[model samples]
Target: MDSDVDESLDIIITNVVATFRTRCHLNLRTIALKGINVIYKPEVGKVLMKIRKPNISASIWSSGKIICTGAASENDAKVGARRLARYLQKLGFKVSFSDFKVVNVLAVCSMPFAIHLIDFTKNNRSIASYEPELHPAATYRIKHLKATIQVFSTGSITITGPNVQNVAAAVETIYPLLFECKKFLGK
Candidate 1:
């Protein structure tokens, strides 16, 4: 009877040790897979913009400004910038160019999105103003445009100027293509 009891105890301990060893192997495998994924991932360094609706339109003006119109909220305007950044990156334009040239982005949510243009040239730096009358909120200068962003009841916006034009055109082309991407990603 004592021998029978000892045999049962030994079996139980062996089973427990086997189970722990299996679990430890699985944990190590998981960690290895994660490290491999990080190493193999592509280096696609581009800015991303997310939007709730695809209601915006973009155009590039002759003054080299890229304009995005139809952002209904401040969030929408931010999305516009993000989208523009990605578009510029894909076109082989340096990310720094987008950062340096796009000095300001203004969003106004009125009947039409009223986007003010201010040149970021050294001599025209004064055009970018944070005045209450010119713009209720602070404004920043991007390249050759001064931007003020506001959310209005209306959902239409027009972006104009030469510098803004190229960027706007690129955005206009990319937004539609990205429409399905948003749905597929469930974003």
Candidate 2:
């Protein structure tokens, strides 16, 4: 019975993820670039990126606020945010970034909300250590590295005290990686 229940849950989650992917496919593909980096700065709860070519830059602050510094237009900035949010979701990270708020479509379009999480495991141990409190309509768990990455689908991610700091620090440390991706995209 337990196994059956677990299997059912898996199927449900898979279906939800698939639906999200399909809905967002077009926008995601259109804005998908070859190179991009995601940096974590836990101290400030911020993630910053430096993109070349088109010279795009942006940041996700701990307060659940997203800012675009070098986008060509408001549309560009929104698209960048949506792409980042979607990619994070695909990677198994729970994201609260709102697609409707960030993405503005002139015509009728469908954008699915999705989040993915990848657990870090090695040496017979998991890395994620933080456990966040339960929130409505959000799902999360701890992975490897004492790092717990939680994402929200309602366009707002809630972070507590220490976890917020950790996220910010991680974003800063990983900024360079995002730049490398940008370079690869030739943008």
Candidate 3:
């Protein structure tokens, strides 16, 4: 964590999405989802299973691809994936939890001071896109951190990207820039 933005910054892990390849073909239409905490939604063409321990929902498709979401941490995501895989195996499917990957991690935090999003976007057009009519959140695509920062007028930000390790890096990178923008706007 950088000292500049460490004072008033609070990062909360909202969700961690993970993907794991089971390397097995599943027949969603014919598979018996009985005795498991799963609901087959025909409209969505997927079986959604909820894992209580890690607190995540696993969406199983006919392709044997599983998407685990709502895990609070990376480890929880992995555990959630494993839990889903084990449950499927018990249901008579040859499953493997190999190639597990974290798709994206979402975190929310607030800035110490107010942000002047309009002015910030104008001065940093190359890094930001702010079209209120199109989208209320001003998005900043920081390449180095490989994160998309959605900044709002209320100074609260949503950071989404592949690497959760970059959360601190993101705070360090954006907070100063936001502060400078606020100062420039005499806020």
Candidate 4:
């Protein structure tokens, strides 16, 4: 494909999952009471919190580990994680933000044409699997990039990877194969 086609294919990041640790333990009960927009589950021993600025949701464990999700970008994920730690600090916890890292990124991209799902999966059986009974989309795995792509018959693909670069690479790598099985409309 030409560079124009490649450039036109845009990868839209939908969610970013990040994780961080506080140096000290967190009191779930205190956070559930003192924190805003929090849901405390005593049975699970964890707290769920939401922040609006970066549009993130956090899962807080008493062990000082926090997992933040729903951010649209890596920077947003980091910012959201920091905000979570700050919230803990405001709650009277001697919190130290450490080991902050973006664990996973979810993105979507649409192809120019629809795909023949069965044909595509059969051609790439080693890396692709399609079980309509189990799920609508076919799952394709790229071992080297550690990325998983869910390809739909309607030309929409959902990709998840460790980072943005890998996710973009996975799309580029699969575009040619998808093109080969493109369904010709009105045929």
Candidate 5:
């Protein structure tokens, strides 16, 4: 059997939202008309641009800001961002792929066994919130670690937060608690 870190849990980045300082105000309509696979929603004032290499969706705003999503890695996100900058530059826009920042990191992992969400939430009431009415799964907010993990009965965990720096710490902190809440014999 593989180790816990390697088998029981695998941190798979699902989506990475990255932002860059283009420093050039954009016209969504113009870019959309010039861009490929671009959708301009003037009502929303954002142009949705899709690229194939990194397979990301870039929301270009008129305020010189771009939000790139659907990337599974930081490098992929940056690559997609730079590609957008180059595309804009090609359209005669002053673009700079500077000040790149990862605004949000969303990842998922699965435990070897199922988790008793009710019991886990009850035990960690101070740090967890079970709102099945609002959400299909239980949302656990570990504020101290700057992470909000959505736990499902299948032992699948969706971890979301603004600080990627705390990811390792949050995973370490939660794994032990998850073990305690593990449903026995695949119950």
Candidate 6:
């Protein structure tokens, strides 16, 4: 039954956001001028750097904090962060890679059946909030997993959690509640 559920749910990780520190100050202006595929936004006080291998984008701050997003997996996120730090090292900064952490993971999965959003919200009012006017999807949060699951009428779910394990656990935790509100196709 667990295998069946896992096969059906098919959670696909779409994005992983991770952050790391260089442990040294970075000169944004110089990086923008010398770095490849870099965009320096002075107003935002960060430089955006893009790498092709892992297809990730990183926001680098002068304070030496870098946030990497768009990685498909946690390992990719770590690799992307390391690559970004190496780029800074080549630019003459005393870059020391430390404090690398995966802060958020976003995944998408589709239920085998359509979801009755209103019914689901009604059944789990305390944890689920539905506002059709403001958003099309009902937002549900799992406190223990520290994950947020967004359910749409089309049976698509978007999950954001601290890590991949938590995201997957959240799907399992919410499945029964969602099954109760599953739409019946036949009249």
Q: Which regions of candidate 5 fall more than 4 Å away from where they truly are?
A: 1-8, 163-165
lDDT of 1 by residue, 49-160 (tens): 2223434444332122344445543345445645544544454434332332232233212221222222111223453343545544333333433322221112222232
Model 1, stretches more than 4 Å misplaced?
A: 1-54, 61-64, 97-187
The alpha-carbon lDDT assigned to residue 19 of candidate 5 equals 91
Model 5 deviation from native, Cα RMSD in Å: 2.5
Tell me model 2's lDDT, rounded to 2 decimals: 0.34
lDDT, candidate 5, 1-187, per-residue tens: 2254455457888888999979988878789878789999899889999999998999888999889999988889999999889999999898877889988889988878788888888988888878778876777777777788888889888899765656656776888787788777734
> In candidate 6, which residue ranges exceed 4 Å CA deviation?
1-7
In Å, residue 84's CA in model 4 sits off its true spot by: 1.3
The worst-scoring run of ten residues by lDDT in candidate 5 lies at 1-10
What is the model-wide C-alpha lDDT for candidate 5? 0.83
Q: lDDT, candidate 4, residue 6? A: 56
TM-score of 4: 0.95
Candidate 4, residue 106: lDDT: 98
Model 4 residue 49 distance off true place after TM-score fit, in angstroms: 0.6
lDDT of 2 by residue, 1-187 (tens): 2242222110010000000111222222222233256555556655665545334565555334455444443445556556655655665445655533322111111112222111211111333222335443232223322333333332223221122234334333322322222211222
Worst 10 residues of 3 by lDDT: 178-187
Single out the weakest 10-residue window by summed lDDT for candidate 1.
11-20
Error of 2 at 133 (Å): 54
Clashes of each: 37, 47, 0, 0, 0, 0
TM-score of each: 0.24, 0.29, 0.88, 0.95, 0.89, 0.95
Cα lDDT for residue 174, candidate 4: 92
